[model samples]
Target: MDASTVPGILDQAHRRTTAGLLMLVTFIAFEAMAVGTAMPTAVAELDGLAWYGWPFSAFLVASVVGMVVGGDAGDRRGPRVALPWGVAAFAAGLLVAGLAGGMAVFVAGRALQGLGAGVMVVLLYVIAGQAYDSSLRPRLFGAISAAWVLPALVGPVLAGLVTTHASWRLVFLGLLPLIVLGALLVLSAGRSLTAPDSPPPPARGRRWWAVLAGLGIAALQYAGQRLDLPAVPVAVVGAAALVAGLRPLLPRGTARVARGLPAVVASRGLLAGAFFGMDALIPLLLTSVHGYSPTAAGLPLTAGAVGWALASQLQGRFARVPRERLLRLGFVLLAVGLAATVLAAVPALGGWPAYLTWAVAGLGMGFGMPSVGVLLLEQSPEHRRGADSAALQIADVTLSALSIGLAGVLVAAATQGLLGLPAAVAASIAVCTALALLGARLAGRAAAPPRAAVPGAGTTLAAS
Candidate 1:
């Protein structure tokens, strides 16, 4: 490639697009972080502490459906048509959520936000795939990962301050204008892009499957929150629903981890499941066992995010290294980090070890996550980019929900005297570490052989 033709992410032609994409990701990250911090206060003010979990569950369920719809729309009409509408929906949801008077209204608003976010995020990946060279993709993903850093560090704290002094509503409402600005920037840059000449073969029954999958995820989340025998039945039903719905939505052979694209998709699930499961539990372990304050406990999470950002930046510089190799290295690092983290549960060691150990794990995620995105793009054809991106995200969200649910079950068991708190923590870490190890073992399968490459501007997967 000629030097003049090789456009960097921040070069004049791509600079506005990159900025807009990062801005959108940053706003989403901020909202995600801020909601957890603000939720208790919001629920209390609404006099609906009982319905606290519904807001989150609603979002998760709706997002799955949105992803399917968005992917289909992107493929048929292009991201230009879908992206602005997604932003508008997200902004409207924010408005509704900010002005909500009841728990029902709040949950409804959250569902809207989830749907919009789901659509917007998938379309973002499609835009990246369409607009940039494959060589530039790693850096684009690195920038997206880095965009989470500021939000991870300060979003919760800012939300807390807002909720304490002003109102929790501001947490939702404050980003409206910024979201609009990002949409406008992307819209301007998007003018140069084009849609497919004709829509790909229609995906029969995929939308319905997406809805079923969403409900399944919500049921699982609800079951995780419940602490009684009734939870068992709910969990079983959820699992059945998830299994049925997920098969149609994902690539063929994904469940069995077939080589190439299927394995790449499966790897995402394993990576997310392991990372997020531990991410959700570590703070609880520190606060409950080590007696650390919430702020002190959260420092480790911030450290992890920082490590993730640093590692992502480093990986983006080494594009020649096979992505599958980087992915394996990441999983190994994550497994080691998780294993070391178990020591934090030991009374003799204290929680200080977590700050360092989790940072190592974060480094693993930094490398692994972006590689997954890049690999997915490399394997998918232009027409299928949106659908394939949606599949990758589905795997991530599904596995994350399941892993967290499993951890929750163990925690509930500890509360019921079935095990000690330390035992529960140890068990959860063990499961997540095993998942990371599994990811490492299967990482090689994620790569397509050189001969399998399709000759086109976009890469296509070979069915191995």
Candidate 2:
């Protein structure tokens, strides 16, 4: 049985703390799903299709900066200090996005929003790791997964409705109340946070991290946006910038996606890329080909919500589950889900099959994401918690940016017909998903932990 099921695995204080933190999840989901749905309209009306990938890409690239900032902030000020700043920054980004009239301004808003989301997400993970006992972690992770189900169900539809009937501007504007509410809840738990056993970060050199992180994400995202520039050259440059960014943060082997820590980080990137890449493609395909209206097309997203929720519930229920098994399960579901999605492009079953596949892929991710968190926390040093957490996001956002950018390229090239977009999307995702499965398997089979990275690009992150 899970510890949470026991009479007192959580004290009153812990329950309050859990309640407070969960609010963050709820708002994050709302923001994520709504932004996604509203984006199609935002770009179409704003005449930002030329930069359609920017808002998402910018957020992802900026998230790298947020990770560095959040890690440094968490190490020095604690999650309490770092988290609110993240929330406030994110809210400000939304405001910027809501008001932007042009693509450049919109991109800037996304960059800032990315920074905020990255910081808040990692800090929240840190808080969850620190606040709960080991035995209770599964339930916590499960709940985190469960949180997505609702927003998945409601968020896209709401965003679609808002976009069709009201205003896409409201998509950003509407998030204000929930964001405010969630932050207040976390703030209320301020007194209960325990101290990290590690000393705070060395104060003098910390500011440079912000610049490094920003540059790193910008370069990596640019590489993703421009991948067809000869695969070797693109990989060479992309690899270089990615390594440069990692120099200070992760362990050495991680950059190569090596045996230990590198593999963990790589797995995170691969899976996230696979999921987000598909997500970036879906609305485009549905609206362009199936004659579905924006609101109607968003139903595929809801399928993901269902898959994520059900799978998360199972992750928690199955207590003896190994980290390896969790990891493997994640890849399998993802591969299967993608396969289902790929089937959509096959032209035999028509459209509904594609929707089914997308949902399955989402469920795969819900099972996988929290499991990765469990692995990272189990291995992280308390002092390095912030850095490790940030690295995970860095991997996710970095890969996601690349994947989405590539998807965009495919859509542009394949614009000859309606079928072209889905075909390109499916093909690109298939490559990433297959690669992700291999990475996951290697991670599960490895006996030793990942080694710590020296401070340099290609610096490998140590497996905990």
**Against the true structure, whose TM-score is highest?**
1
Which portions of model 1 miss their true places by more than 4 Å? 1-4, 201-204, 450-464
Model 2 / residue 385 / CA error / Å: 0.9
TM per prediction:
0.96, 0.83
Lowest-scoring 10 consecutive residues by lDDT in candidate 2?
A: 454-463
| Model 2 alpha-carbon drift over 4 Å, by segment | 1-11, 39-54, 99-108, 203-239, 256-260, 286-297, 416-423, 445-464
Q: What is the lDDT of candidate 2?
A: 0.70
- lDDT tens digits, residues 1-464, model 2? 45555443246656656665676777676777778778888898889788786687577667767777887678667787778799988889888989999879888887878778878878877787777766677778878777756877777778888889999998887777777777776667656554576656453343354455455555555555553556546556665655555556655556566654456666788788878788767766667766668766777877877888787767766668786577778888888887667665644555677678877787788778777777777766677677777777777776776777677667756874544666786778777677567656675742235444323322224322
lDDT of 1 at 138: 93
